[model samples]
Target: MAVSRLDVFYRRLLLTKLFIGGWGKPEDLKRIFEFRKIIGDRERCKSLVPKDYPVYINKTEDLTDCQIHDGFFMSPLEHLVPGILPPEAVKARFQFIVPKKWQRNRPVCIHLAGTGDHFFWRRRTLMARPMIKEAGMASLLLENPYYGYRKPKDQRRSSLKNVSDLFVMGGALILESTVLLRWLERDGYWPLGMTGISMGGYMASLAVTNWPKPIPLIPCLSWSTASSVFTTGVLSKAVNWTELEKQYAINSVYEEEIIKLLEYCGADSFKMMPNLLKNVNSLEHLLGLSGDHEVSVSQYSKTQMEAEVDGGLQGYRAGEREQQLSSVNSKGTSLDTVTR
Candidate 1:
């Protein structure tokens, strides 16, 4: 599609508002700095999670709107800091939607919730039915940790009090996706895929990179990297730089040290962008990476699985792990006899 001159001008104007102009409206800069902290310390950020995690499914019910499977699991972060979270917020819940006549051969798509996404709850039948009934595709929706069913009682709509809270949100989504992807694959579904609209799309990209095999990844209406989305996009205007600098005791938002820190954590750095935009089984040329590995490491984090030994690294064992897991049934020649 060709872009018009007016569209280009408008976009540039928006950019001006996010940057060169005064501190754009009043958004929380502390949160943005926390974002920077995550970028700078990739390994530490990933370490906040357990390398091997478990998920428990409570029940599955068939409703007039859709067949929803409800489940919950303890977050890897639960162990990182024991007993700080109340019991109610400790266990995370999720809903999985399947087509009315879900068959063995149907493909599964994990639909992630964007920030404050209400479409899934408000328009269940109208929003997801066509994808299932007409397209023969199954939908597995994961409610973000701090949003939807798992929202903490005290938290307001889609708002987090601390910067670590945001990183935890992203990490929790990645881990939960791991648990569900394992279940889907273990259940014998073939040609697996993942996708999301916006923030969901960014999280989906993170999940797929950690996944072993190259399945169809359709991150619709999204990009490969998250840096630009926050640093220079419309969202930046929402941040409160004056207060954020005050919180960190900094004088300038564009201080040389601060700029370096932000650049150091860019999504393109340390291979996050390139690996994400791989030309293998991913949708061709839709999204890309930026720089900076982002700190937020766990004892288990690393860009690739092979890079670390003690607790593992960024991506879930990438090539080595996928090879070990058999996609097809070894006992039976075809998928029919595969163990579920």
Candidate 2:
């Protein structure tokens, strides 16, 4: 298939609007260089997260149809990296939307943030509300570290300061997601799953691998390898290649030490698929996760399919709305540095 002229035009327009804030303070990369070993090694990364952590529920709002619960928890990244992160980014924030009356079979999905998604509104309004309305599904929306209330004060609008910020965001999300998953299980929200769009999808893929049990992993509009998106895609225009090149040329540390450490990170989705599938032990697990629901997996799938179809139709109609929201600014610094 050939690329559409409209798509090309969209990309070009996006390039011009996004990432006006170039590569931020070069000093920020120092922490990443120091901790490159931990970032690269899966086992070392896992060691940082505490198995049993508490999520403090700050407040709850009762809606006409559903109830919204807001909460916060200390991100494990603080323990690993110490004072590297801004104070705001250290405390992770989230919103959970649940049905007033629980369905016999409770279905909940954690929706991750896409590129330029700052707060909970995009996922809540576009995805969560519909899923809850149609299928009695609940949604847990996580605030990505480098976004929303957690975003660093000094960072430019949505554009992260340094290359290391991306690594930090990834690490923080992986551990923070597990905390939410365990909390859901404890609260008896069964048939849980994870899903995200674009950048969120890639982050979801990385988070799911660290999970011990099986769950439905749905990553929308994402690919196995991310290198091309940064190197060849229109998004590439957002990168501050001139500044990075200047630093790379002047500082032998980036060339000799930092470049070598980065060789350990890879984001190929295919590599994560097996780990995602390895723990599927039965039919119900196939439907979602292990659950004691009276409803059958086939029946749940039927409901989900219907919800998805309806959601897809709505998404298509709201395509322009979504594009405007995503084009707000380029907060995803990780996508830019992936090319290097």
Candidate 3:
């Protein structure tokens, strides 16, 4: 039987998610490295640090002296992929606000902004200034990829036209977040937490979940599972599916095939459980559940074994890890998976 266009697109998404979710495994990592090597030529990975970015510090001199510092920030460090554009094609700025008294030792809170563009968080930082001041914690804000100062002028609004672009941008943002966090940690600033709303929130969740070195994260107003959005009919509007499908139709014939592959691989199902659980553990267990009420663990495990005959055990293990991670609430929120 032939698959529909939608099914193929779904499969592509599944494969992409599986690839990203499995990034930490040695074998999976090797596969990714190989894949990149085949596609990326011999070019060196892109640098997370920009050239000649300045750092600024502002101090408030009342009874309690507070300070704000600015510099280039990198987060979720991974290998960078160079663009076809010039070296200066993308530029970004990052700012940190801290209480002057605690400058010697302070936990850092990195703020990621939502969809409008890069540097949108700059204004958001201003809005959050009073709360940050009162809380007496240092706050850092960095640019989102393809937004604000980081966006290449020629690509304005163009990047948002495709779903693949969104995923690539998200991956880049994740890489940037990791790199920035590591850089700050090396400089003696501890990453206390990360917070964002909407798209930023989604990115924040990904960073926390996939960080090479874990960091506390507070992701507001974001769903836990990609499946929930995509399968629940909400994706059509949230992601502008109509537009995405149109673009994919024009750009590539394999889009449908990829989507179908993702669906068969259960990407849609894996993406939705987090939001439904509200808490993490239940979410994880649910994800790990390979069978319905009628099926037993042995049966499910056997089924998984069958699925892995050709794909390798990494896919099964990836599913298990995602479930395990989802079940635990690392953020200590009211929605505690353990306690509940």
Candidate 3 local accuracy as lDDT?
0.47
lDDT leaderboard ranking:
2, 1, 3
Stretches > 4 Å off in candidate 3: 1-65, 73-79, 84-89, 117-128, 154-159, 226-243, 246-252, 255-257, 260-340
The segments of candidate 2 whose C-alpha lies over 4 angstroms from its true place after superposition are 1-7, 11-47, 264-340
Could you give candidate 1's per-residue lDDT for residues 127-200 as a string of tens digits?
A: 45667767777777777766766676765555544443554566556656767777787777766788887778
Model 1 weakest 10-residue run by lDDT = 331-340
| lDDT scores of the candidates, listed in order | 0.53, 0.70, 0.47
| Tens-digit per-residue lDDT, 79-177, candidate 3 | 344441123323445666666655345777877876464563454446446545666567777776656666655443423432334444555555556
Estimate the lDDT of model 1.
0.53
Number of the top-ranking candidate, with TM-score as the measure: 2
Give one clash count per candidate, in the order shown.
42, 1, 40
Q: Can you tell me which runs of candidate 1 are displaced by over 4 Å?
A: 1-53, 64-66, 80-89, 250-340
| Total residue pair clashes for candidate 3 | 40
After the best TM-score superposition of candidate 2, give how far the Cα of residue 282 lies from its true spot, in angstroms: 35
Question: Candidate 2, 197: how far from true, in Å?
Answer: 0.4
